[model samples]
Target: MHVLTKVKQPFNFFTESVIDLDAVNFWLQKINPLWSSNKALGKIVQKDIAADDMVSVMIQINRNFKFGQAGQHHPVFVAVNGIRYERTYSLTRLNAQHVLLTVKKVNAGIVSTWFSEQAEVGQLVEFGLPYGEMTVPKTASPLVLLAAGSGITPMLSLIKEMSKTQQLKEQPVKLMYWVKNKSDAAFLARFENIASHYANFSFHVFYTQALPADARVNASHAALVTDLANSIVYACGPSGFTAAAEEHFAAAQNVQTEAFSMSALVNDDIGFVNVTLLQTNKVVSIPKGVPILAALEQQNIKPKHGCRMGICNKCACNKAEGATKNLVNGAQNTERGNLLKLCVSSAQTDLVIDL
Candidate 1:
């Protein structure tokens, strides 16, 4: 039976309060790495190295694991040198027994660096509820997936889901993947195989810094370019790539995007923005196009934060008075009395906010 379908464990007030749960869990691991309580989330089952400094971690999800949409991401908690850190990664369901999470190492990124270089197969990790809007729809409508670099992770999931349904053979789906070079395009073989198997599913790989020199955001197959307006385009990538694709396809009928990092709001009035903290009664001059958290941190005002990519809402606060723009997706929110995430939000004007 599925773990979620099983009856909930009865709470033991005395055991929970009197016993050291941490000590008990530690002992359970001594017997066998996977011998922990059902309440204990999960452990890393295997780790596979990939091209372009990436690692695919297979996890044995515990009874408490809640399934998420195919293209959603979930926060993962891991301890490195005794300190816990949280980061978000897209979940790829391989089977009920295990799942895959592929992480690309960011230069000097703590979590990614740890996983790529040091993390072991049997190390424990915990997952939070998954959430994202980049999921594939039930019906296929000539899908156009534009992915750059690591952004292909979710797109891969969606493509595989379609392949399982044998829709790729009949549906008109085009994938334009941009990478710095061939090495960075980690899943080239898998994509090529899928495209070869399905005549309707065409795959194009562009190397931005390599030969076949015309790689760009506007670069798509001749067939896909003509139908851009009618087909639904889901683009995911770095801030620059996603922003460029969004602008290039601005007139498209339906364009949905998800940026892994923050993009800046492009406007003529780029200048220093004066921000007043309502709670602390402190004022700071922040650059117009930088994350509010980074600007504030430079001025010695540190707000609590986890998963600085705007996934975790730990740094979210009230806008209170002024407008701000998200570095990711390049969207602006001017409404007062709204919650804004500081890690991805940049000041659009001199403003007051509840820090």
Candidate 2:
């Protein structure tokens, strides 16, 4: 007979199960390697710094990797100190034998720490296939690109593609770049040169922290829209910056944004419950303080995760039966079960999940 006990709050499901922990870990190790490509080992040929804390690393691929849409990203797997980790970076430029990636190293991050200090020339690194939904539209309409800090990486890629393909011949391209200072602007020289070379391309740099005596603040959203009226706006930056930009273009349907943080997806108020992997008959009881994904990991059940904050959609799984509370909008999905992001979801009820 199936058990129907109503579980109380705060319990460890891993301790209750009699499954072989070693076998489960071995299977997870085997399954984890399948999600990334091991054949695409590449060597780092060159590394250049465009500004303070902003760097561009060029990798020489052994084979011609498939090209992607202008603003797509790829995950690279690297080994450091005998531990493997994955990090995603946007491609700054595409070439037959080389891929350019710009990265802003964050403090104490595993991948960033390696890239900043330990990575050397001629080292082999595995890269996943190019993936992302934010692509430049194939249209001749006017375009407005807004970016702040390292968020300029993808927009720079799109701009370079447009210039190389001559797609800007008929349409005007305007870019608004927000930076802390001139010292923190990545690819500022390249962008300036591009603006000088292309008549259709125009750019404005907004320095927020410090500026020269002659410099002016270009923070007005009204000025941005007035200059590029009717153009599609694509923005990327910190969550607050992107949100402000979105509010500015609230009436415009063509405005699309990408943020570094999904603050909307972090819910602290949800009281946690339990999740049962139906196929494996494995269960993980989550606490109110921890995410469902974290609880599962303690049981050696590692779901595929990219941006654990719900931006990359890598941790999506079918909710076979059970309810989940969304961290972003505080919406609860109980009926019409669909794909749920395990990273940002907390167990609202006893759940049966496919994963």
Candidate 3:
């Protein structure tokens, strides 16, 4: 057996002077484009149109680019004018040296708007380690992927990956996608092509904002998910869409959901509740059904968080007293010293939490 030795990096005052890891890494990266390390780097090549307000960007990765599973999110960092912003997007691997990132611009989303209108080719960007659990399951049973709006990005990744295997062709794979209109439904042509090639795979696109004269199929969830008893389901979308789909698939034993939006339409009366933060010893009055993270942030208190969707437990805090409600499944809990994810948890009553 032969072993290769690794070279050690020499410390330098030029790029190593900063104490902040991110700051030092940023300076080092900008100073030397050839400074190869374990960090991954990608340069923008082109932005192709996927829909009216959606774009599929091609990025060329460095030699150290880490490979992630299909449906995993890529933490993207870019500088707009003079300020830097970080956002996450579903990334699809095109080849060993290329990847694709899809983004759908929101009404006022800063980073997404930049990707649509301001982002230029040949621009370098930083990507963190991928994170997500809403991937294709490892079972041979039927699979149901539920996606809404830009949530279809990850589903596209799963489609691209599963197409190479015989498992998808042998079993039933279906996609339930919802969009505002036909123009916002990205990748419809590709999905139609895939369905044409594979008999076991199929998809349905639901438009909420418009009904065209000619339609492929009605956007009906009940009609699409007729066999949910023996299938693994994955869903990603806005909070309202995921919440509804969650209720629709509540009986399934294997259901995974991801929602990033902090906004939701309150059907029931949330009213007001008192929240007591033990660390800061501050009391605030807010609605009952909103996430505690948003309530605190409204009062100008910042909390540590990642993904903001309850997948990463970065915002988990202990509750010493009082009841809480999970905004995702609408589950209620009242236990002492219970670890609750603040990003997805809302106060049910007068509460005392160790934030």
**RMSD to the hidden true structure, all candidates:** 4.7, 12.8, 4.1
Cα lDDT, all candidates: 0.79, 0.72, 0.80
Residues 1-355 of candidate 2: C-alpha lDDT, one tens digit per residue? 9989977433225423536655543453365422222255567888777678777788877542556688887777889899888777778656877888777877777777677777777676777778776677776768888888878999999998888888867678888888877788787777888888888888877887774532222345536556455678888876666767776765553877776644444546555567778778887777643457767888788888876646677888888887777654445888646988887676777888888
Ranking of predictions according to lDDT = 3, 1, 2
lDDT of 3 by residue, 138-205 (tens): 87878888888898989999988889766678778899888777788898888998899899899977
For model 3, the stretches where C-alpha displacement exceeds 4 angstroms are 1-38, 212-220, 223-226, 251-253, 267-289
TM-score of each: 0.82, 0.77, 0.82
* Model 3 lDDT, full chain set: 0.80
- Candidate 2: pairs in clash: 264-328
Better of 2 and 3 by TM-score: 3
Q: After superposition, how far is residue 232 of candidate 1 from its true place, in Å?
A: 1.4
263 Cα displacement, candidate 1 (Å): 5.9
lDDT of 1 by residue, 1-355 (tens): 6566554444344235546767666766687665544333667889886568888888897666877887788888888888988788887888886888899998878888988998887787887778788777756577888998788888888888788878787778888888887778867778888988888888788888986574588644433566776777888887778878888876666887877875444656478989999998988899887889999999999898766777658899888888888887767899999998999888888888888
- Model 1 weakest 10-residue run by lDDT: 6-15
Residue 101, model 3, lDDT: 94
